[model samples]
Target: DGVNYCTISLNQHIPQYCGSCWAHGATSALADRIKIARGAKGADVQLSVQHMLNCGNVGSCHGGTVDGPYQWIYKLGKRTGSGISYFTSQPYLACSSESRDGICKNADTSCKAENIARTCSTFGEPCVGLSEYPNATISDYGSIMGKNAMMKEIYNRGPISCGIDANPLLKYTTGVIRGWSLMQDHVVSVVGWGTDPEEGLYWIVRNSWGEYWGENGYVRVKSGALALERSCTWAVPDTYTAPEKNNEIHCYEGGENCKVSAKDESTAAAPATRKPELWKRDEVERRGFQWRGNSSTPSSHELLFTPSNGFPETFSWCDKDGKSYCTVSVNQHIPQYCGSCWAQGSMSALADRIKIARKAEGIDIQLSVQHLMNCGTAGTCQGGEPNAAYQWLKEISDKTGSGISYTTGQPYLACSKDSDAGFCKGVDFSCTAENVQRTCATFGKKCVGMAKYPNATVAKYGSIQGKDAMMKEIFNRGPIACNVDAVPILNYTGGIVTAKSKDTDHSISVVGWGTDDKLGFYWQVRNSWGEYWGEQGYFRVQSGALALEQDSCIWATPKDFTAPERVNLLHCYEDGSNCAAAVSATELVVCVIERPFAGSPACLRSPASGSSGMIGSMFQAGWGVCLERSVARTWESFKKPENHANNWEEAVSFWAVSFAHELAHFESPLHDRQHGRAMEMSQRAVLPGLARVLSKPWGSAVGSQNVVHRKWTLQGSGGNLLG
Candidate 1:
């Protein structure tokens, strides 16, 4: 209750070990939230109860035999939920030096089996031991129970339809499959039969087996949550009667230019009143399934909602104009209509089609990433509905006929949420590595390709243009090449500055691109992300017919502008000063009017410090700028070694001498030289020496590759040299 720690002094007192699971350092804010939310304290304790549900539901669906949502407080009886030690927990043991994998050499160092397992796992593995459990089939019995209850109030949807293990051994067990749920391979559990904590009313609670699984399964939730989630297919039992599907009229029916006569339509209206259970759309379309095409609109098929318990009462759709019930149009992008009628008994029709495709394609595959990406906005995914790609790939894998142990001629398709528009790019799509080659060879192009929509797009990056990226002045904003041309706007392209991958080469990334804009675009593009360079790394392209497809843009500073012109020197001024002393020592200030897009210009001042001194501007400005002042003796020493210019080079050797000198100030390496002697950094020991502005050139992002250099110069002792 007392003030724990002072604001400035708080960081020093963090606890040594976490007090709970899936957490980080002891004192993190997440730890505090969990302490308050779950009444526990552990950094990252924010990995909630619902999130834990995945481990359970996923466990039961894949590994565990029994399942049910026993409360988080119940299932995780002891907070330390136990599991296969290698996957979920690490043993508190030391690895012998010989068994250390050469990663740890000392006795005090350690490595865990969890880390070892991670190293062993691949992207192909989503959850471990997925194939060990029996694959589940969706049961339609639940829907029948719901229907019987609706019409006759006979609600006996017990064990045969949906049952809980309910065994004493499985009670309060985490891995027990409590009951079937909506998602395929998705299962839920019954926590307890008790009054709702918030509602103060009796209810049966369920949990998702995911940490964030329920509202902690806390509400007076609806009955048959899984049934609703699964969207159970509705069909009448033998005892109940309904018209046969074959008797239903369809738009694409036999040899007919049929139109519903006014008299026929009026007669059909009588059925809705007689049945009282029929949907309105069904009644309207009863005369015939012939929908007339409007003069200005595409033909539309009215949807009839057919609920197992009753008829669909309404329909809806979205058009370009945002109308809920849209008229079908020429463009296929808009929704023509939506209705329970439209989908009436649609699930069965789909099931039949899937059975055929599965047998023909030999691809009765499971639900996966490919199914979702190209889902075309379909909200949920159910297996045995159309998944041609998954089916095709699964067939190919099966064709190889190698099960789990036999990772053979072809590897089974791996799924991921990252795949674009629902297709696999294969681990080695570009023929870059051996695995890619193996994958491609085994699958053929289609096997190594996307499953759905044969022509669906896979990658989205625009191709690169010219080579070496260079900073350029604002005036030359064109497709003007950089590396081979003038100056650089940004760093040379294809740079691997901050490597994120274990493979150093993969660290390379495209930094920025150039365009043919007269001025930098993003004039109004402002964001808190990073500094602006052609609208914060984004450039504009001409969209009209004749405009060329522009890919990259690079800019450079004119080498001539770095130094003042003879005329400009005669004008007599420094970066921001004017020197009047003819032969006396004085400070010379240097500055650059930055090219707003790329690279920093090096500006060095001379004389270190001066008294009563007004020096001329050291550099100039024009197609770039020209240097100022007549003191030719002061500015020449820090140039480059000009002998070897044209050949490709390393990041260190090829760095321009002038650029390096500027980088000296930029990195502020603790120089052995005379300048910057009095500079004091917060942690002088932190930086070993001056930092390197660049590490290596992996590729180019904006400009060209070629560059020109300047030779080094010298002046009197103690005199400042501006390169």
Candidate 2:
């Protein structure tokens, strides 16, 4: 035989009992090939097996087939580097038993797992390290059947992955095992083939188990034995260039680039001359007062009125002077393309009003465009009306205390790089529903735990008919929702846009107005295409142009809106006894626990008052009384006291004492006097009530009488008190 040489072999060990032999075997072979193709000049690249195990589309920790690893590499590509870390980069926790089966479990057909295998200086630092191997992909891959073919591939391409019967090789030592049953259940790589004087012919196979298990991490197996070469695969690497370091600042105006077209409808020439039409006052009232026109008319608002007496010459909710009254700036419609302008327009305007109503306190709230997009009855991505979105918001707000959430809570998901029409045509409505449902559930849980603004309603909404009226409304409120012919907006980059059309197909917000000597009078408008587009998510349109004030420009008044009042309450409990309390301006809730609060530290420390708790201990904060429940059968003793006690006395004692203590802290002149005076005042106010309750014949007989009295003294801080 003339062929006996093999490329210098590379070996790897997938530590622990991970069932990701498929990932290890395939990535190891590919890494070896990449090294050989690069002339083996630098350190051998160790492709991440853990990366494939955690982030790949292949099976999980349980054993998987070689085909899946190859398919994942061919599809999503692979990252070449060491094990970054557990979970943060590459997770390698393996099932202790063989009961777990390996299969891709992600719901979506596409693999959307975040890439976490890049090198980093710190364990969880967001930055990917420089030492990480360059990104690489398998250009082409094919199976090599038969022993000679597998051996030939190894000889030519450094190493080839092949399926093997792992049972007979489990306890393998130094020497080659001659014959074993051919049942392939695991995968390994054949790095070389050689003939021994005593063993005859053998294949040098690499194992994923650490070096301590076999002959320095490798095994010399009898050629063709144990189905070692029954099936094998070889792949060729594609030309790869290391990606440029991404150092660009991710501003609100930076995101996926919008496509520009030469024949973009937004910038196309206007049709031959057309006359503007004006609706009569009665007709406008009947049709919801939406404007539809291309050119100006005597009846038009711009022609019929002047700015309100106090309207500002220039104003924007989002201005460079740091006086932005609007909550959110830019947003995107992505993942799937959706025609959701109606939803975006209404939600954006409403969010601005909410910010204005709250006087821009704390962080700006970006209302959920996705809420209206998925739950509203207006229309799907095909197209919709802003009025329907508003009506839907009103109805939902009445039904659910929280009608919409912020962008961080619900986020826009439907995205398309193409036109709104194209996006709607290609979307899967069912999938969109699933995405919204899953996100909303999480939002509901977190929202209830925080101090949320009261649910708001649209008290009054009307179309702004004229330019003066629109500007006045915006100045008085915050922003106004309006319809515009969006054909020219598709290609808008910057500066004043003066294009006009009779057909208004999109809804947007008119945030403020300004004057530009060269570009003429314009309105600062916000688009839902995200901040990366236009001037940091905003653009300017010539005032009274583009049907901006046509058929309907609407503004709403927020009703029943109230801000959350700041309040603090303390819970004091015995070392082992479970007693908890939450105090807000409107309510106080007390709970006696049978078990530990199984929630986050913050939730446990300050549990929301209305949330469900143990039966007898659960009551609204407005009850103005404290509840004491026991885990054992000691309730009969307490029930007897309630029968003879004046309920009003208890309410007076509890709230008067609590309020006195809170006020002492609020009005205290010295830090040391805050807690002490508050507690003393509280105890003094309730002393008479406490004396009456303790004087009861049953209370005197109970051994726990002293405990109840001690509870009141320790009320200001966390402690165990009698009672």
Candidate 3:
């Protein structure tokens, strides 16, 4: 009873306009019922509206009765118990017999064999009909009238479709519409109902015009407004063709090299790049990114999850078991308001997802949406698509090993190429190496572009819609970006938002979902409007009220976004030629010495050794010389009471003289000139430090040196006797 079983939302006018609201409304409601019948478990099953348009002879783009699809699908299932195909098999084409728009002008809107269940080739081949396709069956269907009947049907089962007079809803933005009319022209799904103390009773309706219209593609109209309660259609879901594997055929434009079960939107061709654009203050003074409509195709892959204990009644990435797996809230309206809601929403969700991937253990990894605006990969300050941003980042990750840089590398300026709305106007939005990351010396010193920097990439991304679908994604992974009607939310101060949408022109992130004892189900959203506004930069709204559960929802997977190691070590080769090559002096080098050494304690233990202490000399490796181990052996002998030296100072002086003599040879080859210089410096300079002699063996060199008699004080930090 606490579970959500509703499926994703639908838009009939995408990829072009089509007056197929009747089919969309019917299919969506049927899909929701199917999900409910299935116990709200596994992935939500969606009924194909396209299949209804292609085969069901009820209505076309021009419109038809609300019960057409339900009645037709029910009859079709009576034969083999197989009815309409799944949306994955036959996606919405926005085409029908009675209407045409965009690419649909030349589309085949027929009930022909191929049109019934079709497939196109990715390599430019003729379209063909599929003998086998996944479909959902409707066992029973009927019509209902009156307010009480509609509410009971929905509450007992799922959503129901009904015809409504939408003539007065053209300008509807927020709040419950109160007018009533009997002339029906459009159809929509009534998901549920709620009562507003001030506005009285209302219906939570899901429209087919996409999330950009009427309270995020939904409208809360008075119970009897526009004859909405006059009549409604309901369907009982039967057995659906639930295949373990995806067998649908996918093809590129012009069709040919079609592949079976390739419904992944991530693999689709990337959108064409656009040039950077700047807008005037008056042109984009409202919002940076307005609704450009969804250009990306819907993803067919639904994440399959089986929770061991089911989902919690309330869960949030912002507060999961006392730890917040989310980043701090960001303000997109800073400096001034910028219409980059697309960037702000998408980037914030991405950053939160990255935080979730890292287990919120270390420093947070916040992505730069400004980078998207500057590079013109996603969109400009004028407007763009949030879903497209993920695709662009994925493209960058595939081309280069890196994706978008961190916010520290490139902070948000809220300016485009020509926009003058804020102080950041005229700011360089160029896509250069320096623009990506830069470093400068102190004060007025020279500055240079950085070659590398921290970044996060997208592994795969896709779109999903509806309350349950959005909840599953947030619960399984992290947060998600979704379009919402900003009118009611903009003035929101506190409490749950019961007002519906006009146009979902604003974008925000859905962090999680919770059940309000008084308000019922609500979405926990993160806004980019700053913490000073609306409950600390966030607002809770009735789920699906502003079409927040619609197709405008997009999510991405974080790839290669983990934090870097704490310390970076420089590995030196065995030759020791490139010793301490880094610019920083503090760099630690792990030098490996695999070659054999000559002057070892084992060799010196023999009495036949010609030298008392071997001189440090240059090896075959350039820039570095080997210091014989004999100096350490000599120092060990002096430290003990057994060897020669008058007192402690004399004992230290004997060891110091031996160390200086060998250091001199190491600086130059075993030459007398270097030895004389070292001897002079040892006598003149007073070096203060305790040098610990290392007993490790060094290469053999033929030389013997007498210990010089001079008082020397060596006491400091530990150091190697030989270099």
Top TM-score hit: 3
Local distance difference test, each candidate? 0.19, 0.49, 0.58
TM-score of each model, paired residue for residue: 0.17, 0.38, 0.40
lDDT (10s digit) by residue, model 1, range 1-723: 211110000100001110111111111221222222322111111112112222333221112212122222233323433211111111111122232211112212122211211111112322111101101111122232342342231212111112222122111322212333444321222222334444342223232211111221112223443342331212111110001112111110000111122223321211111111112223334423212111112211112122455311211111111211110001000001111111111111222122222221211111122222222221111111111222222333345431111011111122222221112322211111111111111101111111111111111011122222211111111112111110111221111112111111000011123333442211110110011112221122222111111222111111110001111111111111122122111101111211111211222223221212211122112111222221121123222335333332421132233332332232333576313421222112101111111111112212222221222222346332222
Worst 10 residues of 2 by lDDT: 568-577
lDDT of 2 by residue, 516-612 (tens): 9887678888876543345545678897677887657766666543222222111111010121222222122111221212221112222333333
What are the root-mean-square deviations of the candidates from the true structure over C-alphas? 32.4, 23.7, 30.2
Q: Rank the candidates by TM-score, best first.
A: 3, 2, 1
Model 3: runs farther than 4 Å from truth?
98-100, 243-723
C-alpha lDDT (0 to 100) for residue 106 of candidate 2: 15
Give one digit per residue, the lDDT tens place, for model 3 in 1-723. Answer: 434444544546443445777888888888878756655433345566767787788877666787778878878888655688765345466567655443344556677645654443211234445444557777788999999999889989889999898777655655688886968888999998999998789998887653324554568988778899987899987767532233222232212122333333234442232221222234432343333223234442363473788777788887786456666556454323456778888888888888677665543456767678877445676666776677678778989887786654455555564355533343345554435543221122212223345577877788777777787788887898988866555445566888765546667899987899988999888876543345545678887687676545888888775243422111211111122111110000001111113322111111121111221122322212233353444445555554444464555555556545654554556476776755653454212212111111122212222112223232333322232
Ranked by lDDT from best down, the candidates are 3, 2, 1
Worst 10 residues of 3 by lDDT: 584-593
Q: Give the Å error, residue 432, model 1.
A: 21
